[model samples]
Target: METDLVIVGGGPAGLSAAITATSYGADVILIEESFSLGGQLRQQTQLHANLPSKFFAERGTSLVKRLTSQLETPNLKILRNHTMIGAYKNGHIGVTNGKTTFEIEAKKNIIASGAAENAWIFPGWTLPGVMTAGAAQILLNREFVYPGKQVMMIGSNSFALEVVKQLYECGISVQAIVEASETILSRDQALLSMCKKNNIPFFLNSTIESVSGSGHVEKMTIRTSEGMMEELEVDLICTANGFSPILEAFQIMSCDLTHSEVLGGWLPTYSVNFQTSNPSVYLAGNAAGITSLGSILLTGEIAALSALESLQFISERDSNRKKAALWEELYQIETFFNKDTMLARLELVKHYHSERGLPLPDFVDPLKGEMLFG
Candidate 1:
């Protein structure tokens, strides 16, 4: 198949990019690995402080609905139950829908592939009842299948808290939430309050010493803050250590990447507009790095616009003007619930601007993490 743009992933970012590209008169083919389109958005059930959350608590599901409704243009083609397998030379992409593999010749590629949940491994983690917090979330929210009668979570970040909330809503019980770190990175009071209301105990400065079970996880040992070990009996163990960008496309393209724990592990250094080192490829959303959902949408739109411009599907002048316009529009569209996340935007821009030989933006007092232009 030959198209002006080949987008991988059918999440919010991929859908947004496809919509924007087709609106600009570019032919688009969007491929998603799942049977449905929403990606992780389908599992999420929290209200962020972003623009969309102002109107709805279930913003991810809502965005999925809104984006799909707008993707009715004739120039767009969507392939579900499909995933990109490789990126060959000369802008060719290899994709598969399980039974068959096909090649696509594209002028430009947008990798809104998003992120993958990170599970910090522990003994007995391979047991049947042990899973990632994300797995637990999907089991309850999407699959409508409960993980276990009683679950123990091994992380206390916002994501973990969200999973715990969903578990409660699913009529399941969470035994405890454990964090090895000494401090909680996210300070969302609303999330904390929800945990309190649910009576889910949050344990910090603690680590799961080991998990033991014959067929499924039945019990685990946790080292508490006081260096005392406590044994908890639980049927399911869910770990949500963190997330890393899903960089299969980058790996296929052999793009230069770096490992940044702060930026969510090995990822390509994204230019201000989320361009990877490879000229023909670009990244957006969690694929570049973790940020707010609103910010992810902005990057997706911007990346689509950039990709279209690279293919001469849109002129440079028009792209530059639109990008300038989007910069202001981005602030209006995105909202940060935690004040600390505001600095992530700064770090993304400043580092990339310097890499591109553009003037670097100025720094805030490093609150939790920077300077940027007004």
Candidate 2:
């Protein structure tokens, strides 16, 4: 089949781009790997904010549904269970289900594959009972199951703390939240204070020495600051060190990629419009870098505008106008969030700024986003 735009991920970026592109009078198809969509937000407990409280209790799933439903335009098609594997020079894409590989030709593409959890190696990282923070969240949100009755939560960032809340809501017990850093990152200061108030000790400058269990995780041994050891008997250990974007596809496509530890690893260089060095292709959302739903949606719209311009569906001047307007909106939202302490743990915590009075680049590649945005 052929399309004007092929969005290769159904997460926030791809979905947002699809909606915007279709509204702009382009035929768009969004292919997602998993059966369900919503990307990372699907696993989150609540919508967080770095700005003034707008919609506090808005569930992540609810936002996904509203966006999905709104984007169900006749020109927009969503294909779930489609895993895109290759992008050809002519802009054709190869996608696979278990038994079939389908080729779809498109004038332009958006890579929004999102990100995967980062698994830090430890003595017991490979244990069966060990799971990423996102994985633990999936069980709780989608399957309506908790990781364990009593669990040892590892990592001290937003993802880890969010898991703690999820566990509590599910009526599971948290033995302790272990942090490698001296300070923990959480959205709610009240929650952090409560943890401390309840004497749920937060380990500072500690690491898991080993996890011991025969078949499943039974206990975890950790090294503390004073050269002392602590052990907790828990059925599962949820580790949330953060995430690494799924940028390997860009490498395979020979797109110019740079390593930005700030961007959270290897990332492709793309215009503000999400265009890679290969003008016809684009990337949006977490696939570019870890960002919230709002940012992802904005990136998707900008990317679509650029892609249409590349294909001559939209005039450069028109596309530029749209791009500028969207960017200004994004800037407003981002700037407002910069002062919010809740998102200190998020990767795009600060606005993109340059020192030495040098102006920032017009477009940032994925690799450079980490350094520039980090």
Candidate 3:
């Protein structure tokens, strides 16, 4: 199949891009590897904590519904259960829907492929009762199945905190929260207060030495900060160590990449417009970097606008205007919820400028609300 634009991922970013592009009369194809759209939003059961009042307290599923509702434009085609396998330099991409493989040629492509959960490996991580926080979330919110009767979280990120609250709501016991850091990593004070109110024990400066059971996880040994060993009985171990961007497709497409620890590892080097080193390719959402949900949605629309401008489907003047507004909102979200990501992006742009021998004065740091190169 061929189209004007091909967006890989049906999550918030991809969905937003498709909706924006299609509304402007672009022939858009949205491919999702799952049977349904919404991606991680389907399993999210908490309100957005750091967004402005307009978006704050809104559920992820509600955002998914809002974006998907505008997807009925005639210029848009949805391909569910399709996986992108290969991306060629000539604007052709290989895709498969489990049984048959096909290729789709497009004038422009956007990868909002999102992220993968980071693994926290310990001596019994491979056990049956051990899983990622995302897995437990899907089980509880989507499948309506309980991951375990008594769960112990292995990380203290916001994702893990939210999952613990969900478990508490479902009447499941959260044995404890173990963190290898000196302090709790999650910045959401509300969730932290909730955990405190419920009296969930927190083991700071601690590490899971090992977990043991006959065939599944039944007990875990923790190395506490005081150089002491402690044991806890728990049926499940959930790791919420955060996520890394999925950059396999970007690499296959030959987009230039750079590493930033703050951005969650290697990501495609993108411009202010979200265009990658490869002119026809763009990135959005977690595929660009780890960020809040509001920023992810803005990146999607900005990427679509950039692609549309490149295709001449939208005038440069109009595109710039729309993107300026989107960038403002993006910076607001990042400043309030993802300051680390903002700094990472500044560093990424500096590297991009240096590699291309572009003068620094031509670039501005919108995230910092100041001229970084002047």
Candidate of highest TM-score: 3
Model 1 per-residue lDDT tens digits across residues 75-95: 999999998998666658899
Clashing pairs in 2: 262-370, 263-370, 267-367, 268-366, 269-365
Candidate 1 vs candidate 2: which has greater lDDT? 1
Candidate 1, run of 10 with poorest lDDT:
361-370
Which whole-number lDDT from 0 to 100 does residue 210 have in model 1? Answer: 92
Q: Cα-based RMSD of the predictions, in order?
A: 3.5, 5.2, 2.1
From the highest TM-score down, the ranking of the candidates is: 3, 1, 2
Task: Rank the models by lDDT, top first.
Answer: 3, 1, 2
Candidate 2's C-alpha runs over 4 A off are: 50-57, 89-91, 187-190, 335-374
Cα lDDT computed for each candidate against the true fold: 0.77, 0.72, 0.87
Q: How many collisions per candidate?
A: 4, 5, 0
Superior by TM-score: candidate 2 or candidate 3? 3
lDDT of 2 by residue, 227-343 (tens): 799988988888887777797666655667645565557767655556676666788877776555666677778888888888777898787777766765565555444333113
